[model samples]
Target: FAALARLAAELPPALAVLVGFVDRERRGERTLLFNAVALVRGGVVEQVFHKRLLPTYDVFDEDRYFESGARPLVFDAGGVRFGVTICEDAWNDVDGPLRAHYDVDPVADCVTAGAQVLLNLAASPFTLKKRGLRPAMFAGIARKHARPVVCVNQVGGNDDLIFDGTSAVFGPDGSLWARAPSFQEQVLVVDLAPAQRVAEVPASDEAAALDALVLGTRDYAYKCGFRLAVIGLSGGVDSALVACIAARALGPERVLGVAMPTRYSSEHSRRDAQALAEALGIAYRVIDIDPVFQRHLDALGPSLDALGAPGATDVTWENVQARIRGTTVMAISNRFGHLLLTTGNKSEIAVGYCTLYGDMAGGLAVISDLPKTFVYKVAAEVNRQAGRFLIPENTLTKPPSAELRPNQLDA
Candidate 1:
């Protein structure tokens, strides 16, 4: 309210604000807030709009934090009656992914209330499909209402959620009129009247995928108040790709690549990790974990013998190596305040191929949503785009393995 008061006091007579903010309210026995937007004009608040639809699936838990609003809100802006919809409100369109999730049509209600334009303010997360999904939905809304719809979305990575700005304006005929750049901040000025030119779609699938990861990495580090990053270099496609992304996002000077080798670690694997760091011009450190692993085994052997338990199983020993590496990397991160980037791909993470506290110990998981097969594709794309082997060719070709047991290979 304080922020709104200040803004309203200085609000230009020709302009009005429809912006989102956290709003608090009290029911009979409960006090809760709403993901809300306030309409301000000429030093006064016209209406306080609360978000009606609260998504509670996957990473979204807005239902737990906010109260649902009752109805739609319409306010005048620059002689045009604009309807306001929060992030999920505009997603209630029939053709959208979550159409079944919402029962109310907020946009339709706005149109019934005599709004000339629909303005949706959103902070929606970016999944791979959202690159194409958002524009299609907005265009569909414009065509249905016969009114221009403008969507302004939050950009940059917030933890696991990456918001691709890609803010867009769609004409009543469902033509893309203006589009902001993806994964970055861009100002788009479009005349309220019919657009004279159509907006060009800027990015391809592969390019957008790479940019999304890069922007996510960069924004996650910056927003979390860290400038330096630490990555576990395993000489596999997953870790190699993560290292490349971290170097690109945070710069070589800010990224530190650590290669931890154990008794089972192959010589070529260690060499490949070092080569990657050198090629990327990032600081590199090699830590040998054989001594540490041996000490752990020696210490635990007596306890196991006393318990008369079966000797350490394959999984048990594998976890031991992973945990040791995790511990070492975490210690370095704590000492230097470098945000550790975990390198487990989606395929490994999905089937529990990774150790919980071991390889998964990091401030960020860069490629956890990416499958193992796609990891190679991204690595190849990276090299192809750079016109050289940014990641060593051997790393890309070798069969992936944790190297915790003898003659082990991931096929």
Candidate 2:
């Protein structure tokens, strides 16, 4: 109560503020209900709107801790009347009474009371395609009431339930005016020019997708307490792009690039990798893994030859090289206490193209969700933003290869 009073005091005068809160009280009943509604302005809260519907099925336990309130909350804000509802309010036809049942329809009451806009605040959890339903619901509400509607959602991964906070707004004509990015915290500011009715081209969906991935990477790394990220630079596009993202998110100094060359690694690849590292201004190391590979092959030569598998076979030799490189990188990661970043893209992961426990060995997969095509797109955007080509042009143009075995292309 004191905190609310202090916040209200600091807020601008005459501007209406609606706060949603859950009320808990021990009545004669043994069961509890989760209640939510608007805290009206002018120091008086008239209507008590409650969440009549509660999900008890999967990954939810709302019915265990709340007593549902029994009315629709309609309030005045900035000379335009508005209706505020909680998360489950939109799903129910009527808010029910008693410990478990209350009868009130906030949406109907808002329309009856001439609400110009309807606003809903929610902490809805994410399920596969659950977000797709929000657009239709908001659009239907706007078109039905002949008023604009705004939905604000809380976003973040909360335990087993991830709240994808893609808040959306619709005009009176049921057209989407604005939408926030998913799976992240963002404050979306939209200018409500009701008089102009000018329809601008919708923003690029690709930009939003990329931004989400970036945010996901940043948050996962930082929240997981990884201060330094190390990548195995093969002079290929995947590793280069991952290094770029890590540098951008955690600063260049925090990202370390290790160019582990072998007999198959070309001189051009090494030069390009070095150029990229210099351009990004990150710590770089050239660890030759040829000695390590040869030692392993020599040690396993008797067993490999006795098993009727030739050492020169492409598959056997390539896999041995990849495993050796993986082992070397893991050893470096353990010694230096740096987070090893795996450089496999979605295209590789989807088709099982990546060497298991080899290139896929990392604390977190940065580009696991991005396809090979999108990886290049993001790299291009990064270079475009840098003005000059910070990422080496040769790195981007050259065909990607693991360079694991001698004379072995990534076929």
- Alpha-carbon local distance difference test for all models: 0.86, 0.71
* Per-residue accuracy of model 1 over 12-103 as CA lDDT, tens digit each: 85567776789988778988898999888777877899988888887889988888999878887667788889988998874767564578
| Model 2 lDDT per residue over 1-411, tens place | 344556566666554666666644556874444566545445444344666556554565776766655555677656778777676666543222212233555666767877788888888765433545666777777877778888888776432344667787888888887877676666666765443222231134334444445555666676777788898888888888888878876789988999888888999899988998999999999999889878877898778788886545446666777777788788878888778888888899899877877788877777786788888887887787689787899988877777765565654
Q: What's the residue-level lDDT of 259 in candidate 1?
A: 89
Predicted model with the maximum TM-score: 1
Candidate 1 runs further than 4 Å off = 26-32, 96-98, 193-204, 302-313
Candidate 1 weakest ten by summed lDDT? 195-204
In model 1, the Cα lDDT at residue 366 comes to: 93
lDDT of 2 at 30: 48
User: Which regions of candidate 2 are displaced past 4 Å?
Assistant: 1-81, 85-115, 122-141, 153-169, 174-206, 310-316
